[model samples]
Target: MQQNLNYVYPQVFWVDGCTSASASSPSAPPVTPFPPPVPDRRTKPGHNRERRSVGFLVIFMLILLALTGVGLSMFQIFHLEKELAELREVRSAWPEQSMEKEARKAAHLTGNPTQRDLPLEWEPISGHAFTDGIQYHEQGLVVNETGLYFVYSNVLFRGSICSSQMLTHIVYKKNPTLPGSHVLMEDKGINYCTGQKTWARKSYLGALFKLRKMDSLHVNVSKIALVNFEESKTFFGLFKL
Candidate 1:
């Protein structure tokens, strides 16, 4: 009674106690839920705060280093300024020291021995022709300051007839403590001239002597008449070191 339809058609089947096919699809074989996607741990609020704190700490250290460097530079500048001040003070006093040295004590006397006594008298040259210290007195050069001095004297003896007599020349220093003048230098000429015709001789005494304050210095000769009065030929002088 039936002719074959020969037409194929899709089929639908329903399980027992299911309302819809999708809901009843065997519950997707008990799926495992993927562990809630791990919540993106690097983006947590506490971790972000820790990173910010580290950045702030690094910035603070850099600031501290910069301040320390500034302090050191300031200290060096102060030290250099102090040294400069000291150098300036020393320079300011240099000229005064040089001037004190230049204003030293000294004197010069010219001419022959005028007196033959122990403290011989001298003939001083005209003003500006000879120099004398403020301590110099008549007939002698007085020392006002205690120091070393260079003393010198020269004498010329001349005779028409050579007597060959002994000529004595001496420089003496006198002070209040000494009873008599002390001989600073001495020279003796014995049998000096050989011929009788217009004989001449010279005696010179020069040396360094340590002198005290208030001391007096003078030149002496055995015979004052034998001395030459010329300024260039006969002279006595002293200068402080």
Candidate 2:
């Protein structure tokens, strides 16, 4: 029993075999090592505000651009409307102006033929008579306006000896396209008097015609000697419709 023996350490007493100090301390609450400090993932308040501000700015810019576009479009439309209104006003006034101009073109002329059986010549009835629409040349009335017109003429025939010969009166027109003058109206009379005596007759012509510019009108009679040269008895006139 007294033999000398070497003390051998128990395997359970070794630090590697025993529980760790962290597990042994019961009074200190469990030293649970917190997982390596987790990095904060939440965005900062300032960063969030900056992102919101950026989004707001972008939206505001988009809205501003839209408003500007709308305003420009409205302005353009208003301008176009104003121009259209002005054009309409001009169009409305055109007809009245044209009518006034046409009214000023009325002409009343008196026959002034120097020979018989020839085309009747004419002179302005009054100093204020308008003859701009008509041209008097070679015993003809040349039309300068292409429109419907009321044309009138009167002629007085008188003779000391009534031979009862046929009297022919005609209104002739010469068109720019036609080669010759064509009779527009004609009147004939025979046996107007029974015996050899003074005889007098009056012929009048009035009609509406669609005349073209450059057309010419003239009067003709079978006998030039029978015509009375009185201005009041022989006249020609025209007025636009």
Per-residue lDDT of 152-216 in model 1, one digit per residue for the tens?
98888777887857899999989987698899999999988787678778999999999998898
Distance from true location, Cα of 39 in model 1, Å: 74
TM-score of 1: 0.57
Alpha-carbon shift of residue 42 in model 1 (angstroms): 63
Q: Over 4 Å off in model 1, which ranges? A: 1-94, 112-119, 125-129, 132-134
Per-residue lDDT of model 2, residues 185-219, tens digit only: 78888878777578888988888988888888888
Tell me how far the alpha carbon of residue 3 in candidate 2 is from the true structure, in angstroms, after superposition: 99
